[model samples]
Structures are given as structure tokens and as C-alpha cells.
Target: MAAAKIKKGDSVVVRSGKDKGRTGTVLQVMPKEGKVVVSGVNIAARHRKPTQVNPQGGIDRREAPLAISKIGLAVDGKPSRVRFETKDGKKVRVAVKSGETIDG
Candidate 1:
């Protein structure tokens, strides 16, 4: 797998989907699946029919995984591509648009 441009805790913006253009922090990264879970985005609601596990199961709402391609690293409130560059003898992520270095 290539290097991860967007990691957990990264601020990202949805490129397309029902939540297009929405911004949120990345809650999880599933590189193996090529998906990511962002906070307050792509929420899926499940209605439970009351089971032994949960007697009064009304609804379960939570963030769902979105394709990594649907998201971009947020830079200055906008979506931007990320690139890696060697800085100070270490690798770091940089915003392609504004040329700002993200935390290493």
C-alpha cells in the first residue's frame, strides 16, 4: 500500500456523496479496506427489532465508512490533495494547494 496521506484525526472534506462538501475529523482509517470513517458524516441508521442483546433497541445511528476517494485533506477550509516531502530529515505531509506542511 502507498503511504497514507490522510490519517486518523485528520480534518477532511467530503468530495462527493450525500454529505458532499461537509467537513469533519477522521475517526478511523481502514487502509486495508480503502475506507475511512469521518465524524458527523455518512451516518447510517439501523432500526432494531428488540433482541435479547438490547431489549429496547430503538435505532442505532453511527458513522459509516466512506471510500477514501470521496474525501480530501482539508486545507484552509477547502479540499486539497496531499503529498509527502522530506523535511528536516523526516517525511511529512504537505498540502498541494497552499503548500503548507501538515504535522509529520
Candidate 2:
């Protein structure tokens, strides 16, 4: 496997979709599926009937998985491409816009 460009907890911006221009933290990364679940982005609502376990089950709203290609790493509230760079004998993700290191 190669190094992951995007990981959990990474702030990212939606590149193309209904939620384009929206920025959020990455909650999960499914490398095998090439999808990612981002907070406050790509939300999906499911209408369900009441279940025996619980009482009300009107509409369930939650973040939906988005294709990995539809997002870019965010830096300072802006979207930017990421590239790996070796510094101090360690690999780090750097934003192309400001050339700043991205926090994990």
C-alpha cells in the first residue's frame, strides 16, 4: 500500500458536488473504497418508520461518503493539493498553496 494522502481528522474542502466549496474535517477514510466521510459535508437523510427498539425514527441525517477524488486537503480554510516531502528524515504532507505542512 502507498502512503495515504488523506486520513481521518484531516480538514478538507469539497471539490465538486452539491456541497462544493464546503469545508469540513474528514471523519473516516475508506482507501479500499476510494471514499471518505467528511463532517458537515455530503449529508444524507434517510426516512424510516418507527422501530421496536426505539420510538421515533423519522429522518436520519448523517454525513455520507464522497469519492476521494472529489475533495482536496484544506489549509487556512482554502483547498489545496497535497504532496509528500521528506524533511528531517520524516515524511510530511504539504499544501501546495502556501507550502505549509498539514497537521495530522
Off by over 4 Å in 2: none
User: Per-residue lDDT tens digits of candidate 1, residues 1-104?
Assistant: 67778999999999999999999999999998899999999999999898898989798999999999999999989999999899999998999999999986
Best by lDDT: 1
Q: By how many angstroms RMSD does model 2 differ from the true structure?
A: 1.6
Best by TM-score: 1
Candidate 1 C-alpha error for residue 69, in Å: 0.7
Clashing pairs in 2: none
| Model 2 lDDT per residue over 1-104, tens place | 45679999988999998999999999999988889999999889999898897678799899989999999998888888899998888888889899998853
Using Cα atoms with residue i matched to residue i, what is each candidate's TM-score against the true structure? 0.95, 0.90
Could you tell me the lDDT of residue 2 within candidate 1? 76
